[model samples]
Target: MTDRHASAHWEGDGKTGKGTITTQSSVLDNNPYGFNTRFENEPGTNPEELIAAAHASCFTMALAFQLQEAGLKATALDTKSVVTLVKDGDGFKVTKSALTLTAKIPGIDQAKFDELTGNAKTGCPISKVLNAEITLQATLDQG
Candidate 1:
């Protein structure tokens, strides 16, 4: 088994506070985030976007392995995930994660593509860890 870690340091209050996020890999080293970044769309990264990135990457990798196991190869697999956050009576809650996938795989039938993508959507580690609703839309690119 393996474990990954990330850390965040915040100062001040909710509306005016700021924070820096760092990951074990240093991909996001001392990245800034705050109310303006999360709610006001100021230009920095937010938690929801990070979750979406993680979900997209995890699902795509899972699908790649699934295809390999099925003796199929993909020229490209582009995936996008959107995480929705909403107010849940007392606080905020992540309600859903919607994934859109466009793939270029040779010699793959619609039935097989759908089945493999469905499996990946449910079997990905990030998808399994998320408590919110998950949805996927997959498109097979022939050109």
Candidate 2:
């Protein structure tokens, strides 16, 4: 079992507050975020975007391992995740995460590809931890 940590420092109110996020790996060293970045689509990072990146990376890695276990190798795998946040009863809530994958696996059949991708989509840790709906769209490239 492995444990990872990240921290955030926030100041002021929710509407006008600002914060900096830091990860244990220091990949995000005091990255800035705030209401403007999250809601106004400013130039900065946001939780939803971070979740999207995590989901994409986790799902892709899971798929790679699944393919390896099945004795298949991929030339390339590209994934994109979109996380949707919406207003719920009294506050904001993450409603769903959608994954889009385009893969180049030399000797994989459509049926096998579907099986592995489906398994990865459900088996990835991020997917398991998320309370929102998860959806995947996968494409196999033979050319």
* TM-scores of all candidate predictions against the true structure: 0.98, 0.98
Q: For residues 58-124, what per-residue lDDT tens digits would candidate 1 score against the true structure?
A: 9999999999999999999999999999999988999999999999999999999999999999999
Per-model tally of clashing residue pairs = 0, 0
Residue 94 lDDT in model 2? 98
- Please give the distance, in angstroms, between residue 26's alpha carbon in candidate 1 and its true position after superposition: 0.7
Q: How does each model score on lDDT?
A: 0.98, 0.97
TM-score for predicted model 2 compared with the true structure: 0.98
Candidate 1 all-Cα RMSD: 0.6
Deviating ranges (above 4 Å) for candidate 1? none
